[model samples]
Target: MTRALPSGIGLMPVRRPDDHRPRLDRLSAVPITDLARRFSAATPTSARDLDRLDGDLMLRGFAPVGTGVLRRILSRPSFFWMGKSFRRVDDELIAGHNFFTALGGSRGLPFAATIGPSVVDGRPAVRIDYGDPRLAGPRLTRRLYDELREIEPGLWLGPGFLRIGQRRVTVCWFAVDSSVGYGEVR
Candidate 1:
């Protein structure tokens, strides 16, 4: 029963090649202890929710639901083509962007998303927005929005529902291996 972001809130800003100083929300500004706690509570639960846990949860932007539960959505074939970037601006702030291609292939559009500090779901979680991380820059980045909960220092997980053909499938978790995530890509 989760609802999508409003129609025109726009995408979160991303660091562009030309901009030397870009303004972004600093996660450090938010309470650390609370953020961590909220993240742990959002893990996969119940039969349907628990099923999403797989391999490399951190890399997929989620935390270990439990000691044994894992998540591997990022490397999943659906997200293999996905590329992302992150830069540590301050202590708690991790600036980044996620580029995915699903609806794009059929709709002739591109998906570029950004995540940052926010208060949603009645707790502290990262707000993910689809569109140009560059905003109104030359690229068509903004499209939709999703909220991610941090499981640990460098891992996150968020529910992603997508429309494929006629049915909308719920992609319960996504990983963002913030640590080594950007080592290969820009």
Candidate 2:
């Protein structure tokens, strides 16, 4: 025999558990027109040629070290919001992959991570990995860029070269659009 609840009592439906979907509150959608406008306004015509250097960091061979570099950089407070994984596809190669809220906390900064052969035609011409955040200051950005150029000249100044073990890596500087929620490096 089954027992019935009181007429005045209300029954609440049980919710089925599933894969956790990240809340959209943390993600901001910025208009493309606004991004373009800001890009043009900030960038100079002389250095505009650097715009073509954009793409994903394909970890085809250097998966371990590449992943380590990403992890190390993300560990910092500046890049705390940059999700773990890098860009997987090559659809609209602007600077790096569009980081869809994967890793980091609520206040985490959103940026792109790309590694590939080159930075040609804005498709990662060489094996380069870049992280650009909107929160970083101009001085900090310049300092990081200069440091990279000094430490790993091969990875930064030169074309590109693969590192077998745990070696120092370079993090390039890029511009971030807080209004729209995206970034791009020079």
Candidate 2 lDDT by residue in tens digits, 79-178? 3233212222334222222232223222111223233322212322222232334223233221221111111111122222222244433232222211
TM-score (C-alpha, index-matched) for candidate 1: 0.37
Model 2 lowest lDDT segment of ten: 145-154
Global lDDT of each candidate:
0.36, 0.25
On lDDT, the candidate that comes out on top is 1
- What's the lDDT of the predicted structure labeled candidate 1? 0.36
Task: Please estimate how well model 2 matches the true structure, expressed as its whole-model Cα lDDT.
Answer: 0.25
The residue-by-residue lDDT of candidate 1 on 1-186, one tens digit each, is 432322221333221221111111122223334444555586422222212222112223332333223234423333433434433333433334444344342111222333343333354455444443433322323434455654544455455544454443443334443433121212
**What is the number of backbone collisions in each predicted candidate, taken in the order shown?**
15, 18
Model 2 residue 98 lDDT?
Answer: 25
TM-score of 2: 0.19
Q: List runs of model 1 lying over 4 Å from the truth.
A: 1-79, 87-95, 99-120, 131-134, 137-141, 161-172, 181-186
Model 1: lowest-lDDT 10 consecutive positions: 16-25
| Alpha carbon deviation, residue 121, candidate 1 (Å) | 3.1
